[model samples]
Target: MADSVPKASLYYYPPSIWCAAVLLCLEEKGYSEEEIDKKVVDLSKGENYALSFLRLNPKATVPTLVAPLEKTLSAEVESRFKALTETKTIIEFLDKSRSAFSRTNTTSSAPAPALAPATIAFTTVSNSIIDLLHSDEAHPGAARWYNARDEATLAKICPSLQAFFAAKRDAIAASLAESEKGAIQASAKTKKFWEDKSTAASEFAQLFGDGEKPESELSPEAKAKREEYFNTAKLVWETNLRNVLTRLSKEMIGPHALGDQLSLADLHLGAWLARLVTLAGGDISDKGDVAIGKLEKHIGNGFALPKDFQWTPARRDDTSEVKPVVQSKLAAFWDAVRERPSWKKVYANGLH
Candidate 1:
């Protein structure tokens, strides 16, 4: 009976935190990647606005779920294929549509959304964090230093959010090669494709915008503005992130976003925190070095953390030592998340 259930094809971009959350949820719900296709949308080049994509989602947001129409005995439900938008809506669909209920006897049973409290918490806190992370003010700093998050655990945790876009870079290289071969007809498409893969760094400068360029390379004027904007972004995100951590830890009285069990809230918050960790420019090894012997003995998971200098904790605080405290708290939560095997699988196999 379970074999007959419909699966969704998730259309997403590697860098989207919301897409990361949806993926975690999909895995938690026992949907395998084979059952659900992971389609990467190249947003850096304006592919999200591509007319072909617009047909499925006009707004061109990431993490869109497309599923076959379910056959129901009721006239109320539509019979067309479902193209769901938004992480929240898609998650709700995944939760409720687990098994088919006979439409004839629909009134005999009550169908309720699962995890009301967790959903409410996710909507309130995690949603805010995601927005603050993606706000125009924050994207620049994140895109500027996307590579700093390279850690064994992170490489294990967020490949879906990294490799998908890495593939886009490869795609662009191939397209550029095609153009070099004098494919004039494909020139316009390649132009838009390149545009979709670029970040603010590329938009402002003629650079590939891969976050490989050092801040020293930017023009004086651009460098000053970048520093100014990043500082503001740091303050804004730090304030919100600390608030969420407090609520999850001190107020909730458990390791997760709501309580002992993981929920949608954790998925949302974890994805954002993972990004913030990368932007911090330090890895789990930095903290491990402080207690590496003790941590290795205690972890029991047998996964050796990489010892690298790619990650260096960025200073977001100018007046206080609070950043470490917050980072510590966040790491504690990240550790709990890593303990979950399903959570670990999403980041496995080169992010599949």
Candidate 2:
């Protein structure tokens, strides 16, 4: 009889940064699409907040992996599963589960590339970099909060953000209505879940949605609150993200974050940087300097590479004094990561 191995299901949204990280990890580890069931949760429609999905992940975040329990591996017991909700946990599971000696390596003939650092020192550096990238201040999603600098940009961005929140709010309202009308009443727990989601959505819509008046015509209090939100976001980006980038540049050894070899840190950094690049209006195809320039423009004047960092000097003329060229190890890391097959495949649709 054919083996009755239970397959895992990956719940993800294509445009999510951490989802992209998990997807990249799967590709890098040689997990074929057929090996795992891939389910897309539409965040725009608030599918993540549905009672069914929330049962699997109370936080309603992706990418979540539902893996078969070890006891079920023998095929004697009915299949039991567990959910992995965090990106770091998911990546570690994928790496260790598919290693050369792992029984789960049945799908691939070649040994999976070792992504974890082999040495203690390299491992320390790798973990630290990964933590930095995942920090709240460096989160790529926050890029949208402060990306618009002037009136023209806000005019374009505000409406889109408003629309996004409006859709989510409407979706949550629909779900709540449906539950209320169901023949079998939702359990108290389920009812509370829907109510909580509905309240949160309404609040977000109020804060982010455009009302009858355009933003410019809004009351002074309203305008000030909105301005303060964006200002705080910008401050967080300037202080935290700049520090994160500077640390990455200084810690990087070369082509990758740790050195020549790709480590777990590279996977997290690659996905995070790609999202930042796209949010900053830079294309995945942009050269290192071009991408860096776009990010600097978005971040304003305070963002700069470390002053003491070495760079090849350029001279305007033979008699002219040399000027340090704009370059960064962070950018070099980006250039290297974008060239990987896994990156190309995961981002084939577009950077998210």
Candidate 3:
């Protein structure tokens, strides 16, 4: 009978924090990535292993797992996932099957959006800290402190959030080449794509803080080649941010509040919020911006975070730390280089 159980395969994106959240849950459930592919999704040429795996799971989203082993035992085994989607539901199902119904309040009116506060908070703060640290312009004190975090602690106890984002940024960079090429081929469409993306970013800025044009709006040729890809990416980021904030708001004021156990929502929203702030020239405070103020209050009161949520304690002496040079040019070049297939080849070959 044990042989009848299915062998599980997880289909997921390396960089997705939500996927990472699901991964953590799976890890707690004793699943291993050795059981799952570590490949990043290839978005160019419309290729994604995760998408292909969705032949069974039509959702086509990351963090999906399939139980192929069960197919050999029974016809239904092929239909049922080894267990993906709904961490709490899966836990409850397993418990109920064993007559271990502990009368837990497993179900709630809140949408079972996988990116809950705990998941989001860890992903967001960690990513924000990492990104800031990696940036050349990051405050020397901040960078030193972040770098000083024990490597083992970050690897083991930091909850695997870094792995998720690293995988995502790499995947996005890899996929952009195809997206850029496609955009370049369609001049008018590409212009629309960039304009649309810029407009979305502008709106996000306006909503959060500022609506001024980014100084680096694309050039005519580059805009034509890259706008659509950025536009689509911007839209995805926008939706994710909104979803996180809306859920958080509902949780704060409504009956569905995130009681005690904060989730991925906090991290997801926080990261994007930080991004929006960064793009808008670090003006997180809204002047006469009622909506922004309300949102800030909601974030503050809802999460019960420290007043210094954004600050990290310094780990190095002020005099000993050297200010890091901003890598804007190098970072831009790296960003462009990462999109090339050769980059992946080099990575695979351990050449870089």
Top-scoring candidate (lDDT): 2
On TM-score, the stronger of 1 and 2 is 2
True-vs-predicted CA distance for residue 323, candidate 1, Å? 27
Instruction: Report backbone clashes per prediction.
Output: 12, 0, 20
- Write the residue-wise lDDT of candidate 2 on 26-66 in tens digits: 88888866678899998877888776887899888899999
Off by over 4 Å in 3: 1-4, 29-54, 57-60, 68-250, 253-257, 261-352
- Tens-digit lDDT track of model 3 for 1-352: 1333444555555434334434434333233334333444432222331223434444334545544433343534444555355433333232232222322122222223232234565545434433432233432212211221222322232223333333433443433444567732324543343344335433332221211223254356433423443443333333333344343333331111232232322222232333333332333232213223333343232422112111122548867655533222212222232343322432332210
Off by over 4 Å in 2: 1-3, 181-197, 211-216, 307-326
- What C-alpha RMSD separates each model from the true structure? 12.1, 4.8, 17.5
Ranking by TM-score: 2, 1, 3
- TM-score, prediction 1: 0.55
- Give me the overall lDDT of model 1: 0.51
lDDT for each candidate structure? 0.51, 0.77, 0.34
| Clashes by residue pair, model 2 | none
Model 1: how far residue 208 lies from native, Å: 7.7
